[model samples]
Target: MRKIKLKSISIAIVLIALMLGSCSDEILVEEPRGVFTPDFFTTELGVQGGLTYLYQSTRSIYGFAYFLNLGETGTDEYAAAQSADNNFHDLDLAGQGNLSSTSGFSIGRVWGTSFPAINTASGIIENAEAVNLDNSLIAEAKFFRAFYYFLLVQTYGGVPLDLGGGELKFNNSVVRTSVRNTVPEVYTKAIFPDLEDAVNDLPDNPRLTGTVTKNVARLFLAKAYLTYGWWLENPNSIPTYPEASRTDPDGNSPSYYFQGAYDVAMDGINNPGPYRLLDCFYDVHVATNDRHEEMLFYSDRTEESQIYNEADLGWSGTDGGGPNTAVWMVTPNYTTITVDGVSAVQREAAQSYGRPWTRMAPTINVFTETFAEKDLDSRYDATFVSSYRGNWDKGGDTTPTITAANGMEIAPGDAVISFLDDYDPSVNYVNGGNLGGGEIAGRSDYVINLNEINRRFYPGLWKLGTYRTDNAGGLGSPNGALTRPFPIAKFSELYLVAAEAAVKGASGSMSARDLVNVIRARAGKWCYDNGENEPRVEDNSAAMVAATPAVVDIDFILAERSREYFGEGYRWYDLVRTQKWTEYASSYEIGGNSASDHSPTVTNRTIQPYHYLRPIPRSQIDDMDMSQAEKDAYQNPGYQ
Candidate 1:
C-alpha cells in the first residue's frame, strides 16, 4: 500500500494553547516569540497546515497500544494476558490493579491529545472562510472538531467545549480555570451540529485517499445520534457526570434519535460513494489489502518510509502513543513452541506471526460461543492465527528436521503447533509437560484442543498482525511498530448500525433480522482458510441467511458486532452504549497462566456503575486552578 504523506506543518499554537491548565500561582509570562497565532489560519498555507495537523494527530489515539487497552482490556472481547503489567491489569477491573484516577491505561490520550486537535480544528474553522478556503476544506475542520468531541463525550461524559476562550472558539491565550458542560449540552451544542454541517458540505468522493468524506460524516452523525439515544434511554440507570437529566436539549424522545440513526445509516448504505464491503471478511483485513475501499477511515502507517510512518520501521521497542503496536498485545509468544528441544515456530515479522507481548488474550467464549459456526462463518479463520508453522530455518536453525508430536519428523514450513478446530477426546494432553500442548494420534503437530486454550497460549490476532516487506528471508523487525493501517471504521459496520437502530424500535423497510442477515451472508463466503494456510472457495451464504433468528434483538446485534470487529478496539464502547458491559463481561473463563495449567477458571470483574465512564486524568485535575472541592466535583462520580 502506498503511503499518503500529508504535508508537515508546525502546530505550535495548538501545543501552547493546551498548556492552559498548566498555569501556576506565580505565572512567569513572556511574549510569544516563535508561535503562530490563530490569525495564521486566515492565510491559505495556514489553513492547509492546520488541516494536515488534524489528520496527523489521530495516530496518538487510534493505533497506540495503550489506547487500545483502554478500549478492549476490560471488555468481553479481551482480558489482560499472563504477562500484562499494571497498565493492562488496571483496566481489567479484576483484582490485579485499581482503575483509579492515577491509572496508567492512557485514557488521558483521549483527553490530552484531543483538546489540542480540537483547538486546531477550531482555528481552521474560524479562519478558513476568511482566506476563501473551499467549503469542503472548512468541512474537514468541522468533521475533526466533531470527531474529537464524540470521542471525548464517549470516554469522559462531558468535556469542556470552551478550551480557554468561549465555547468552541479558537483560544490563543492560556487560561487555567475550566468547567465541563453537561452531556446534553455537548451533544446538542457541538457534536450534532458540526457533524450535520460536515455531512452536507463534504464531497461524495474524498479529495485524498484517506481524507474524510460525506459518507464518513454521515456514519459519525448516525453513530452520534444512536449513542445519544442510548444516553437518553439510560435503561441501566448509569449516572452521568455533572448530573444532568437524560433528556435531549431539543426535547426529542429517544425513539426520535433512534429513528434518525436508522434513517441516516440506511442513507449511507443505499448511496455508498467510493465505499463498499470487500468480497469477503479475509479480504478486509489481509495486510496486502490494507486501506481497501471497505475501510471508511483509518490511521495510516507505512513501511516504505520511516519518516512518513512516524516511527522507526526497523525497531520500535514498547513505545506507545503513535505506532500500530496494538496487535502485539494480543499476539502470543509463538517462538516458544519447540520441537525436539529446538525452537520450531520462530518469530518473524509476518502477518501470521509477529512479536508477542502477551498483554491481552481472547476469552474462551470467543472460540466456543462467539464463533460457534467456524465452518459456515469464515470470520473465525480470518480473525485469528490458529496454526503455528515451523520457521526454524528463518532463525538460522540448521537442524533440518525435528521430531514433533506422534514421533513424526517435520520440516520447515510444516505445522509445528495447531489449535484444533474441534476438541478431540483421544488426544493425549501433556499435563505439566514442557510443551503446552497435546499429541494427537497420527498427527505430527502439537495440538491444542478448544478446551485447552489459555492466557499464555492462544490464537494471535492475525487481522491486525504485523506485515513488513523488508524481511529478506529473516526475522525482520519483529519488535518494530506494525506498518499496516489500523482500521477505525469500515463499510460493513453501516449494516450493523442500521440493524441496531431497527432493534431499538426505529421504523425501517428492512427489519432487524433482514439487516443482520446482510452481514451474516457476507461472512459465510470464504476465499482463503487462515488455519489451512491455503486457498479455499466456498459459498454458504444461503445457510447463513437461513439461520438468522426471525426476530433479532439488541443482544444479537451486539454479538454480531463482536464477531465482526473483535480486537479492533470496538468492544467497550459497544457494551457501554448498550449498557451490557457488566451483564456480558462480569464473569469469564480462562485457564491459569501456565503451560501446564489446562483447567479453565472463572474470573469475575467488579464493573461498577461509575466505570461506565473512565476517571478524568489525575494530571488534568492537578493542573487545574480550581479548589480541592471543585477539582473533586470535576471528576467523574466514582473516581473522586
Candidate 2:
C-alpha cells in the first residue's frame, strides 16, 4: 500500500507517456522516444520502474476525494459540505439527480484512472516473460489489474476488456480490439483469472503494507463471487435483472458465483497467522498503527519519503500525510474557539482541522437509525468528533481576513460540535450553545439537530481529520501532499463477507448471527463510556435475528456494513449490491428540525434500478472500436 514514488517510476512512465494514451482510446506511440522501452523492461530497473507506475494507480482508486465521492457521498452514509453544484453530491442524486457519464467527478475519473493502470499492469504481465525477475512481482502486477477491473465492473458494468501487452502486441493494436466485454465475461475471463493466477504467485502471508498477499487476494476473490451473485444474477435469489443476464457472455448459474464467494471467504476467514479484528474500532485508523493485523491492504501516502505531488499521479486529491484529507473532512473554520470569554492568538493554516468544506457529513440516519442503541455502541464516539477545544496555540494566520486573535481558548469540556438527535427549539437556535464570546452560542449553534445542520458546517468524522499534536495540529499550510495513508481493504470486512454469504445460503457451521455477533462484541468492548469493556450482546442469535431487516438476510449484512465502513467508501457499492439503494433511501427524510426545516437533503434524491451500475462514460463509448449498434449493446441497462 506504500506508494511507489512517481520520480523513481517517471523514467518508465516517460516511455509509456510518450505514447500519450487517451482515457477513452489507447493511442500509444508506435515509435520510441526514450530508453525505457519494452526491451528495457527485460532489465531489473525497468521491471521495477513499471511496477512503480502500477503502484501509482492506487491513489485515485483509494485517495480521499475519490473515496468520498464514490463510497460515502454517493450513498446515504454522507452528504457533501459544498452546495448542490458539487459533483460528488450529484452522485447522491442517482435516482433523479444529475449523474451523467460526462460528469468529471463521477464517470470520467473512474474510467480515466482505471484504464491507464490496467494498461500499465498489462505491460508488466505480458513483458515480464522476457525478463528474469521474481514471479511474485509479476503476480503483483496481475493483482493490480484485477483490482482495477473490479472497481470498473462495480461502477460501470461490462467495460471494454483490454489485455494487450509487449511492444507491438498490446500497444497500438489494443484500441482496435477493445470492445465492451460482458459483465459476467469480465468477471470470469479477466478479473477472476488474474486473481487466481495471482494467488498462486503471491505468498500466503506478507507483512508489508504495500505488497500483494494471498489474504487480500482471497478476500477480493470472495467479494467478486459475492458481487456476481448480487449483480450478475444469483440462482438462489430470483433473477430480477433481465437485461444484465441477457448480455451475460458466460451464463454461469447463480450458485456458481455465490458458492465461489463462499469458498474464498472461508479461505480468508481461516487464513493462517493472527489476523483478527482489533479490540478498538478507532485503532483501525491512524497513521502510527497503520500496519495493524486488521488491515489487509491500504493506500500509503509517500510524500514524507518520496519526491512528488498528487497531480503527477493523475489524481483529484493530494497525499494523506500532509493536508489533503484534513482539508476535505475536518471543519473548515473553527466553530468553538472561545471558552466563556477568552481570545486565542492568530492561527496558522497548519493548525486548521482543514479549510472546513464540510463536503462529507454523515447522514441523520447515522446518528439516529444506525445508533438507535447509542448507549450500547462505542463506535459513535469512536468515529465522530463531537467537539473541538482550541487547545493548541494559533501561532499566526496565513489568511489575514480570518484572523485568530489573542488566545484561541476553548476549555477541554467546551463543545465545538455536539450532535443531538432530539431538538429542543427553545435553546436550539438564535443563540445555539451558550458557551459565549457571542460566536456560535447556545446548544443550537455548537450542537445542532442531526436533521437540520448545514452540509458545509456539519459534524466532523474524526477518521479523515487528524488532530496532529506533532506540529501543533499540523505544519504550515494545506497542500495536496498527504500525511496519512488511506485504507482500501481491512480484515474486518472478511467477517462481514462471511456473514453475508452464510445468510444468502444459510449453509455453514457458523450462522449469519454468529459471525455478526463476533464483530459486535469488539465494538461494545471499545465503548467510549469511560472504561466500559463489555459485550452489548452475548451469543444472542435470536435477538440479532429480530433486529434484522428480514430477521437474518442481506439487509442485515448491509446494516452491519454501514456501521463498520460508513465513511470509508463502501456504502454506494453495498447499496447497489443489495438492490436496496432506493428502498433504504425512501425510509429517511431529508429534513431534521421537527417537520419544518429539514434540507431537501436526500428526500428529493431518487435512485432508479438502472442506476445500480453507473452509466458507461459517453466518452468511453465514443472511443470504442465497435459500431454504434455494438456499442449500444455494450452499455449497461439504463443509459442512452
| Clash count (model 1, backbone only) | 0
Task: Provide the RMSD of all predictions against the true structure, rounded to 1 decimal.
Answer: 7.2, 8.2
TM-score of each: 0.94, 0.78
* Error of model 2, residue 506, in angstroms: 5.1
Ten contiguous residues minimizing lDDT sum, candidate 2: 1-10
Each candidate's lDDT (Cα)? 0.83, 0.56
Model 1, stretches more than 4 Å misplaced? 1-36, 431-435
lDDT of 1: 0.83
* Predicted candidate 2 versus true structure: per-residue lDDT over 1-640, tens digit per residue: 1111122112233222222222312321222223345565556666666665665556655654545666666566765544334466566673424766665454666666676667667667767877775687778878888898898888777665643332112342223334455677678878888888887787765623355588788888888878877765532332232234533456666566777777777777777444678876757754456657887876655433333334322122433312245335434334334333433221233222444444455666777677555444556655655544343334433322221212232333233334553554533342322222112332222445655654444555655443222354433333333445667788888778878878777366666777787677666654233112223332333443344443467776787888887677788888777777777764343443222233535445666767777776677667655578866765666666
TM-score, cand. 1 vs. native: 0.94
Record all residue pairs in model 1 with backbone atoms less than 3 Å apart, i.e. clashing: none
Error of 1 at 61 (Å): 0.6
Residue 547 displacement (Å), model 1: 0.9
